[model samples]
Target: MKTTKRVIVLAVLLAAVVSGCGEVTVESETTSTGSASEEKSAVAEKSEEASKASDSEVKAEEPTAEESAAEQPAAEEPADTATLGEKNALASAQNYLRFAPFSAQGLREQLEFEGYSSEEVQYAVEHIDADWNEQALKSAQNYLRFAPFSAQGLREQLEFEGYTSEEAQYAIDHCDADWNEQAAKSAQNYLSLMPFSKQELIDQLIFEGYTREQAEYGVSAAGY
Candidate 1:
């Protein structure tokens, strides 16, 4: 009876130990799984924070509308400002040309003398509406009223006044002044200024750019 009781006690102790070992193993496995889950969550949270931080930095780097405009090149003046300047220049040029004839260069110089800039002067002169040929003709007529001139002399005077050679020739050809009568008038004016012999006056008329025949005719006509 004693031997049987001891065997039963030993078997019961073995079974109890086996049950405790199984519980310990199950508890350890549960803890390991929980720790792994916690580690994964921490990694995901860090990734989310880094992503949000990157998004914020990108937004901060972008420029606003005003800042973007400031960073680019400066814009030009308003179109109206340029247009107004041009209009003022044209008006000033018209006023100047209304009183007198002007060469293209002379007009530009006159505008500049009035304190307009070179570009403005250029714009004004180029836009002025005047017939250059008609201007030359008027200038020639005015000169003839002051003094008699040979055809060549008149052309040279017109050229000196800034008319082109062709324009000067055009004016001379168009003016209906009688060359012989102009020579006679010039001789009379000269003799009125100073006493001269017939030969001396004829030579002087020739020197004044009259033709030899015109000079002879003028001295004879002057009663010299």
Candidate 2:
């Protein structure tokens, strides 16, 4: 009976140890599973934070192509209008000069107030083809027809009308005017009304810008 009791106690002790070992293994497995779950949750949270940061950076940088184009032309249109107006003024000034031949300097000042470029004004002046000599002759003829003038007086008038010295001289030389005859007729007409001395007549003619020889010839021919 003693031997049988000892065997039964040994079997009971073995069974208890096996049960304890099984319980320990189960607890270890549970702890490992909990640790894995915690690590997965932490990784997922980190991934979400990184994705949010990337989205925020993309939103903060760079405008859209349409927005960029709109900003550029909104600033450029007014500048283009200013440039176009300037060009139009210069072109108009040039076209106007074709009908009226103004002096280069005179036209330049007029065009400047009208907003023309200096180069455009210069180009218009250089391209004019008006006959200055013919203009001078016509001017001389007009003065002689309206107001009787001596050669020197007519020269002054032509000069005032913007004719060059050579051009004025040419017009005076070419006109069909007889200076001596004209002077005699004037002197006779004056002496007919108011009897003037020979010296007084000469002085009057000279004061009218006649040459000394022309005045003397005129007085003698007038029988004064």
Candidate 3:
């Protein structure tokens, strides 16, 4: 009977210890589950707050494309009016024509460089007269003063100075000075300085300005 009482006490003690262990395990599981739930709730709240802040910032920002375009400066327009003195414009036009006879377009561009308006340039060039005929006449007179050139030779010189065919012809027709006599006299004067034989004198006279016939007559007159 004592052995049976001892066995019963030991069994009751074992049952109490097991019950205590089971209660501790249950409390631990509950604490772990509650901590996990609280952590998840805090994380969710933080994410929602961050999302709201981002939305507010985006709404506050200005439109980048429109703002950039508006902030850019405007392009400048070209000036309509041109400035040039009348005398300067006229001088430039004359210099441009001296090199060669220019076409209408070429002349316009030249006048523009001197700062004249298109209308003013055109008017100036039209009114400013270039006397190529007088220029040719001057060249002919200058050439004849040095040596008496043939009519054909004078015509060539005139054409070289920018005179027209008609103008060249006019200069030849209206030459007031008797070139042939002048040529013979010029040759005779040169021969007087350096005497030559009849044939040699004729050659020098012809070279100076006299025609072949005039050269022969000049030598005969000079007592060669």
Q: Which one wins on TM-score? A: 1
Instruction: Report the lDDT tens digits of candidate 2 across residue range 1-224.
Output: 99999999998999999999999999999999999999999999999999999998998777888888987754444343335545565566567555553433445577777766776555544545446666577678877776557888788888876678887887899777778866776688778889999999999888877888889988998896
Model 3, residue 151: distance off in Å is 2.9
lDDT of 3 by residue, 43-146 (tens): 99999999999998997785688888998898889764534565567677778767655434446676787679777787666656865555556557777777
The backbone clash count of each candidate, in order, is 0, 0, 0
**Candidate 1 lDDT tens digits, 77-173:** 7665446666778798898778877666667777788888877877787778777777788788888899999887898888887788888887888
Residue 143 displacement in candidate 2 (angstroms): 1.2
lDDT accuracy of residue 19 in candidate 2: 97
Clash list (residue pairs), candidate 3: none
Best by lDDT: 1
lDDT for model 2: 0.74
Model 3: CA > 4 A from native: 1-89, 92-127, 192-195, 204-210, 220-223
